[model samples]
Target: MQAPELVERMLRGDRRAVARTISLVENAAPQLREIMAGLAPHTGRARIVGLTGSPGVGKSTSTNALVKALRARDESVAVLAVDPSSPFSGGALLGDRVRMQEHATDGGVFIRSMASRGHLGGLSWATPHALRVLDAAGFGVILVETVGVGQAEVDIARHADTTVVLCAPGMGDSVQAAKAGVLEIADIFVVNKADREGARVTARELRQMVGQVEHGPGEWKPPIVSTVAAKGEGIDELLGRLDEHHAHLTATGEADRRRFARAREEIEAIVMSTLRARLGDVHGHAALDKLADAVATGHGDPYSAADTLLAALDT
Candidate 1:
């Protein structure tokens, strides 16, 4: 199908169209620019929630429980699970679609597993564009589940309106979360597997850590919610906290600010990628090779070589 027609179907909430469009974005298909352009007008409506944590932190389980809770409240939800890529095939290794099988038959729920494809920061590079597709598809909420690669996963904060960082007991996850710099980015923290031993201690440590942050009287404080996601315990409370955070953002006009920042970052990323591609094309013409040889032979400094490459782009 043509990009325009595909975008039309996507805006009408056609799941197949959404999937196909996302695939095009992932593969960098030739029609991607047209598809994104067509979808732009319909974007920016969905609430984006990013979930990140260390490995074995029950992110997938918590995500599944959260989906059920949201569905019960009559909300249409879309989940974008960013899984690690297979070194051989560059496809999702830990497919969240398999983990979230219960939601497969639900018309109101859309789940997609995207390979991170060696992108750092726990998310696929295509995430921002895929989000545009989901937002345009009329979903009330969009959940982004990262690959959970510890500290670097903090990138989710820039993409999500609300960031939920998960940690479980007995894995030193609390300390790791602190070291990972997730403490600063989390809007809501979940101690999943709350029924396990030491869960309260984990919660207490998080509370203490959160208490140390100085905030204005009206500033939103990150809430640490305990959950046994496997059993669906505390899912309601987690959802409640998310709702409270969203309300705070809306009432304070922070939502608009966040969305605006997200757009700015997205635009900047696209521009950088375009420039890098153009640089590669210039390199193919041997302009870069000569510069590299000059630098290697100590005939020119690296800085001057870089300038020459940039200057070549102008010609």
Candidate 2:
């Protein structure tokens, strides 16, 4: 279908169109410029939330439960599950979809699994574009479940309006979250598998850690919720906390600030990608090779070579 037709259909909530648009984004199709232009005006209406944690933390289970809670409230939801890439096919492992099969037949929920494709940040490099597709498709809320690649998962904070970090009892997740630097980025923390032993200890450690970080007056403090997600336990409380965080974001104008930063990051990424592509071209590569030779031989400084390359691109 033409870009305009695809955009029109997607905006009308056509599931096939939404899927096809995300495919185009993942492949970086030539039609994206037009498609994105057509969809841009309709974007920014969806609440984007990100869920991340270490493996075995029941991130998928919690996500499935959250989807149920959100749908019960009559909200339209889209789930973007970024999964570890398969070595042979470079596609998502599909584990997340398998776990979420209960929602497969629910028209109110849209679920997509994307392969991280070796992206180090727990997300596919195409994630931001795919998010735009979902947002323009009129999903009231979008849940971005990142590949549980500990440490590097902080990238989700840049893409999401609210970030939920999950921890499991006995996983040493509180210490891990602190080590991974996710504690600073989390808006809400979930101690999933709360029925397990050490659950209270995990929650206590989280609370103590949170208390240590002094927030300026009126600054939002991350709240920890305990959940045994496999049984749908504590999901309503989790949803309530999510609502509170969203309200806090809007009331304090943090939502606008976050969105502005997200847009700026997106734009900067595109510019960097364009530059890298151009630098891979034959002429630019040749220039870089010559500059590298000069630098190795002490004939030119690295700074001067970089300036020359940038000058070449401008011309």
After superposing candidate 1, which stretches have Cα over 4 Å from the reference? 84-94, 118-125, 150-152, 285-301
Question: In angstroms, how far off is 224's CA in candidate 2?
Answer: 0.9
Cand. 2 Cα-lDDT: 0.84
Taking all chains together, the TM-score of candidate 2 against the true structure is 0.88
Cα lDDT tens digits for candidate 1, 133-247: 8999999999998866553466678889999999898988797678778878999999999999999999999999999989789999999999999999999999999999999
For candidate 2, write residues 259-279 as lDDT tens digits.
888888777777776667776
Clashes of each: 0, 0
Q: What is the C-alpha RMSD of each candidate to the true structure, in Å?
A: 2.6, 3.1
List TM-scores for all candidates, in order: 0.91, 0.88
Candidate 2: regions farther than 4 A off: 84-93, 96-100, 118-125, 149-151, 282-315
